[model samples]
Target: MTYKEFMDSQTQLEAPAHLTPLLEALWYAGRDEWHRAHDIAQDNEHDPMHNWLHAFLHRQEGDFGNAAYWYRRANRTVYSGGLREEWQEMVRTQLPA
Candidate 1:
C-alpha cells in the first residue's frame, strides 16, 4: 500500500487527534516539505506518533542514523506500532536520491 492510501485510511477511521499532526507531517513529507513536517511534529511531545513522525522526517531528510535512533526512541513497530511501513516508505521516497 502507498503512504497516501495509508493516510487516507487513517483519516477514514477517525484516527486519534494526537496522530493528526503526524498525518499532517506525512502530508508535508510527501511533498518533500521536511521543515513543515518537522514543525508539525515538534508541537506534540506526549504522543508517540509525533516521535514517529519526527523519525520519519529525519529519515526523509537522509539522516538515516538519527531516523533509526528516533524510531527506536519512539518504540516503533508495524502492528500496533505508532507508524507503519507503507507510510514510512512514503516518507522515504521523498528524500533525495
Candidate 2:
C-alpha cells in the first residue's frame, strides 16, 4: 500500500488485511491505540523492525529509558525527530511505492 493509503486507513475500524504485523502496529499507533500497538509489536519479536516499532511506541509513551533499550535491540540510534515525523518515516519506509 501507498503511504497515503496507510494513513487514510486510520479512519477505518480495522487495519487493512494485507498489512504486515509492523504495519498493523503502526496503524493502531496512528489511531492512538498505544497498548494495542505495543502488544502487536511486542508479540512479533523475531524482527528488528518490530523492536524499532516497540521503541517508537515507548518513545511516544514518554518512556525514554525503555525506548533506548528497544532501540538498542533494533540496532538503531535513538530517534531525535518529533514523534509524528518518526512515525511517518517508519510507515513510509515500510509502504510500497
Candidate 3:
C-alpha cells in the first residue's frame, strides 16, 4: 500500500518508544512528502535520529550539501534500517552517482 495509507492505518496506535514521531516522518518520506516529513521531524532539535531524517529528506530533494550536513550532525556510518529497502537503495545509489 501507499505510505500515506500505511501511516494513516498506524496513527491511532501507540508507536514504539524510541520511534514515535520518527516512524511517522518515515511514512511521509516513503510517500515522497518531503515537507510533511520535515514537519514531523522538526521538533526534535538536537536528536540524532531527527538529524538523520533531515538528511534523508534533503537527499530525496537532491540537496546533497544539506544532506551531508545533517548526516554529519547525526554522525552515522550509513543511513539504513527503519527505512524501506527500496528507498534505502535509492539513497545508496545516489551516494556516488
Candidate 4:
C-alpha cells in the first residue's frame, strides 16, 4: 500500500485487516481514536516500531516528556514536525511500494 492508499482507507468504517499493528494504530490515530491507538502501541511495546508509534501517540497527546522517553526507547529522534506531517511520514515509511 502507498501512503495515499493508507490515507484513503481512513474514509472507511474500519481499518483494513491487512495492516500491521503499527499501521492499525496509525489508522486509529488518524480517526482521533487515541485510546485505541495507544492501546495497540502499548500492547506491542517490545517492538521498536511500536515504541515509535507510542512516542507519536504521546506527542499527539501533548505529553512531550513521555514521548521523549518512548522515542529514546525506539532509538528515534524526537520529532519536531507537525503531527500531521509526522503521521504522514510514519505512514509512508510503513507502507509498501
**lDDT (Cα atoms) of all candidates against the true structure:** 0.62, 0.92, 0.64, 0.91
Q: Which digits, one per residue and each the tens of the lDDT, describe model 4 over residues 1-97? A: 7888888899999998888889999999999899999999999999998998899999999999999999999999999989988888888788865
Error of 4 at 76 (Å): 1.2
Model 1, position 67, has a per-residue lDDT of: 80
Better model by lDDT: candidate 1 vs candidate 2: 2
Instruction: Rank the candidate models, highest lDDT first.
Output: 2, 4, 3, 1
Question: What pairs collide in candidate 1?
Answer: none
* lDDT for 18 (candidate 4): 88
Clashing residue pairs in all predictions, respectively, total 0, 0, 0, 0
Model 4, residue 67: what's the lDDT?
A: 99
RMSD of 3: 8.4
Candidate whose TM-score is highest: 2
lDDT of 1 by residue, 1-97 (tens): 4445644544343332443565667766655667877888788756777777777777667687888876787798423333346456545454332
Off by over 4 Å in 4: none
Q: In candidate 1, how many Å is residue 52 off? A: 1.0
Q: What is the C-alpha local distance difference test score of candidate 2?
A: 0.92
lDDT of 2 by residue, 1-97 (tens): 8988888888999889978889999999988899999999999877999999999999999999999999999999999999999998889889875
Q: Candidate 4: what lDDT?
A: 0.91
Residue-by-residue lDDT tens digits, candidate 3, 1-97: 3344444544544332444576667656766677978987677848887778887787777787887888898896455554466354433332332
lDDT (Cα, 0-100) at 83 in candidate 1: 39
Residue runs of model 2 more than 4 Å from their true location after superposition: none
| TM-score of candidate 3 against the unseen true structure | 0.61
